[model samples]
Structure formats: C-alpha cells, structure tokens
Target: MGVLLTSCSAPSPTPAPRPKVAVTTQIKQLLPATVSNKTAWSEDIYQAFTHQKLETSVSNLCSVIAIAGQESNFNADAPVAGLPHIAWQEIDRRAAALHIPAFVVRTALSVTSPTGKSYAERLDHVRSERELSDIYDDLINTVPLGQQLLGRFNPIHTGGPMQVSIAFAEQHAENYPYKKGNSIRKEVLSQRGGVYFGALHLLGYPANYTVPLYRFADYNAGWYASRNAAFQAAVAYLSGVPLVLDGDLINYQDDKPSQTELAIRSIGFTLQLSQQNIHQQLMLGQSIAFEQSPLWKQVFAAADKKRGQRWPHERLPGITLQSPKISRNLTTAWFAQRVNQRYQNCLLQSRRE
Candidate 1:
C-alpha cells in the first residue's frame, strides 16, 4: 500500500481596504501646499473615494485635485470673476426671453431674499456660485414668476470646487453618502458634496480611453464623446460625408435623424443593418456595449481597411465650450490638455514627495 500526500491550498484572502489615514494623506500631499484647508480637502476627497468605492490610485486622486485647482483653486465658495454682471445679464436675458418686462422683473427682485438684502441687491453683490445659487433658490421660492422666468430650473448649472453640474448631482444623488442638506443643489456647493459629485461625474463611468486625456475630454464634453468622436471621424473618412466630430451619435432632442445617424444610415445598408436597427445600437453609445455593437465593429473595420491603418479608438471631441463662466475662447481639447498638464505635474509632485 502506498500513501498519497495531497495538499489543499485555500484561496488568498481578499486584500483589505487601504487605511483611511494613509489614503487621505496621499491626497493631501498631492494638493498644492498653497491650498488653504488642505486637511479638509483631503478628508472630503477621501470620503468621496470610499463612498463610491472608487480607486485611490495616484492618477485618479490627482484628476480630482487638478480639476479642483483649475475650477476653484480649492476654495469651496470660489469667487467667479464678474459674477455679478453675469448674473444681471442672465436675468435680463431670461426676462426678455420670458416676455416679462424689465420693470416687472426688477419689482420681483426688489423683494427681500433670505439674506437681509433685496434679490436685486444680492445679485449685484454675487461673487461666488454658492451665493448665486442661494439667490436663485430664494427668488424661485419666494418671488412670483421666479420659476417661470428661470424655466423652473436654477440658472447656475454648475458650482462648488470642481463646478459639477447641478442636474448631474441631482440625478446621481441616490448614492450620496452624506445628508443632502435641503437639496442636492445646496449640497453641491459644499466641499464634501462637490468633490463627491464631481469625482462621480469625472470618473464614475467606465470609458475605454487609452489615456486620461480622453477622460478629461469626456469631463468637458459628455461621456463617450471622445470615443464617439473617433467613430464620427471614421465614418466621415469612409463615406466622404462631411461630419462634425462633436461626439454626439444622435440628437436626443429631435426625432429626425441627426447628421451622424444619417451618415450611419447611408452606410449601414452596406453593413447589413437597417436604420431602425442602427438607432437601437446607437443608443448603446452611452454604454461600454457600444464598442461591441455591429455599427462600431463594421464601421471601424471598413474604415481601417479603407485607410490601410487602424482608426483611433478615441480622440478629443471638437467642442467649443460656451458658458457664462468662460471669457476667452476655449475648446474641449484645450480643457483636456490643461487638466492633463496638471495631472502630469501632480504625478511629478507625488514622485518628489
């Protein structure tokens, strides 16, 4: 009789979550030393990472820090240059668009806001986005025609450290770890809420980007805008149908076919997909599944064959950013490059420290 020895090995235990203090310390170091309230920024960002179960890699952490630096320089109540004038301009524009007389609008704004000053007075003194958002809230709730004038939505679409979109914050508020404080809009003005939501917006979704630059572009544009822009480029090259590589697959607002959709329909017949089928697949453009779609595979394969080279998987979306906050001409490429420069600088800082 021969005795046989058998060895049983247990699966390795899952790696423990990184210590909170260690994670927060790394984030604090990456932040610019000149940034006031460094520890607060670190702690808030740490909460965002943990709550979302987002990876705390140096790159991911730096992406959040860099956007904060660019948008607010770490100030939770960041002062927008000439915000008062901008607010007044928007008020007038809204008033005109809503067919409300200027005097009527002024009379409504004359009512005292929650802040001891008239809404008009507060608008004149508005410096930070937080103040502006508050004024809007007071105006909408208290003043007559406030909601109608503002189209039942706050005029200040973005706010806080990273200037995340309020709509985005509101829509994604279900996973928010902290108390939302009256509304998600109010929370978006806080450091913790802002970073959490901004990080969610920036890195929350999965993108098949080869580098962080495309992700940065997606931050400025919409998600998959970079990838879709590449698709648009390939379609244009193959079909000779001039197209704007703005990364929009189909116009969501219109029932009629968008230029991208029309172009796809023109070639989709050859790719053995009908317009209806094409649309069903293009809707997946918002998800990772878009990459596996018949449109994606056939279009890229055709384009790659026609050009004798593989088309880009992703590219910077050609979108010129138009916002009240912007004074100079800026494009999505500029935004991506600027943030990526900060990303590289932060990487250097991490190495040096």
Candidate 2:
C-alpha cells in the first residue's frame, strides 16, 4: 500500500458560542436623567422588532438598542422647541406657493376635532411630533377643507430629546410588542420595556440594503428608498443625466412633467416602454409591485455589474443631523457610523461568547 497517501484532513474547529452581553443595563445607564419613561422605551424597542416580525439575534437587538439609546434616550414625549416657529414659516411658504390664502389656511385650522377643540388651539400649542401628527390626522378626518389645504400634511419632525419617526409608528402599529398597553400613545412613554420595543422599531427592520446609511435614510425618509435609489442611479448613469442620490422617486413640483419622469422618457424608447406605460409603472413604487417589474431586474443587473461592488439600494443622506441642543454636524452619517460601530462591537462580543 502506497503509504496511505489519503492524508487525514485536520478537523475544523467548531465556532464558539456568542457571549452573553448585558446590553440593557449599559443602555439604561446612558439614558438621560430627564427620561422617566423606561417602560415606554422598552416597549417601543420590543415593538420595533416584533412589529416587523423581525427575528433578531440578541446581539443584533443589542446593536439596535445601542442606537436607540443614543438617539432618543428613552423620551417618547420629546419635542424640538423651535419647531412651532419653523412650522409657521413652512405653512406660510406653502400657502404662498399654492395661492391658498393665508387666512384660508388659518381658517382650516379653526375646524374642530371630535372633542370639538379648534385645531388652531392644537396647532398653536403643538410641541411633540406625535401631538402635531394627531392634530393633522384629526384635520383630515374632521375638517371638510382639510384635505385640499393641508393634504400633504406630514410635518417633518427631526429633533428634540428623542428623534422618533412619526411616520414609522403610524404605519406599523400592529407589530408593537406591548400587548398589555391600552394604546400606542400611552405605551410610548411607559417605561424601559416599552421604550426598548419602540427603539427596535426605529432600527431593526431589514432591507436588501448593503449598508446602514439607507436604513438611516429610510428611518428619516421611508422604507423603499434603497431600491428606488438603485433605479434612479441606473437611469441617471444610462441616460447620461445627473440626478441626486437622495432617492426622491417622484417630482413634487407643480409642473405637469416631473424631472424623474423626463429621465424615464429619455430611456423609454431604449427599454421599449411607452411614456404612458412608464408613468403607470411609477405608481407600482408605492407598493412592492415595482420589484416584480422586468425593468427593475434589467436595470439592477446592469447597474450591479457596472459598479463592481454592490450598489446601495437606498437614499443618499438627506440633511445633516443638526440641532440647537447639540453641537456639531451630527449628521445621519455620523449616527449610522456610531450604530454600526456598536453593531461591530456587539458582534465581537458575541463571538467571544
């Protein structure tokens, strides 16, 4: 027998179990003293993960928890103070743009809620995003003219103690984890469990994204920016057109033709799509239906090849995160990087376990 040249392969070492991390305690200690809402924080964090039906590893949850802890510090009722002034200015600007009289806009506010309280009173005193959002919801529901005047009425709220996503909470409420709570509103300011759950909602959902930047963007913008950005970038690249990577899929300007539509027009013939067909396809974006369209497959495949590395299927960073409360640019990029750092650290800790 030739000296048994069938050499024995060395046994592969089994990977180690991830370490048991005590993240919740560290997260708790880092929260602001002003935050009396520990239950709300935990509930929100739990709700964030559970609502998405996200089956996260404990380490992953910790990573997300770290970001939430840093972002809101467990304050569900947090409000950005100068928002009232900024909101008034925006209202004026919008009124002038649409030729809607200032008085009419103000008049719309005079309409009452189910409680018969004038919206003007609510608007004047509105401090938190949630509070303002409730007012808008009531406006659309109760006031007959509300839809015509303030129909596009999601006020952008990006500051204060805790940076909550009003849009996120509104759409994904059923997934919230606090079964014991009477309502989502009451749950938001409850305690650690509630806040933790809410925090997870703001951070844990998954996407086919390559980086956390778009998640930050999605947290700031919406869920599908990553996919839309890839399409936008492909169209821009192929048509030799320059476009912002901000992932604004539609043109909001009053002009009948949108720039995005025009860009699609330039490529329409190449793809053998009629202008009308392209316009119809745009609506699919509001649903996940666009992902099934052949255009998406073709463009995404070509774009991936051209970029060597995978392209991020999300919005580029929007506004830098700045606040009168905090010094420095504190941009979304900075926030994502910090969360990612914690994520990596958590991973390392997991490996050690």
Q: What lDDT score goes with residue 41 in model 1?
A: 90
Off by over 4 Å in 2: 1-44, 47-52, 77-162, 174-206, 252-257, 286-289, 302-335, 345-353
Each prediction's TM-score against the native?
0.93, 0.58
Candidate 2 structure quality by residue, lDDT tens digits, 116-149: 7787777777786557656655666667656655
What are the per-residue Cα lDDT tens digits for candidate 1 across 187-264?
999999999998988888867666788888888888889999999999888778999999989889978888988888
**Collision count for each candidate, in order:** 0, 43
Model 1 sits at a Cα RMSD from the real structure of: 7.1
The numbered model that scores best in TM-score is 1
Q: Let me know the TM-score candidate 2 reaches against the reference structure.
A: 0.58
Candidate 2 lDDT (Cα, 0 to 1):
0.55
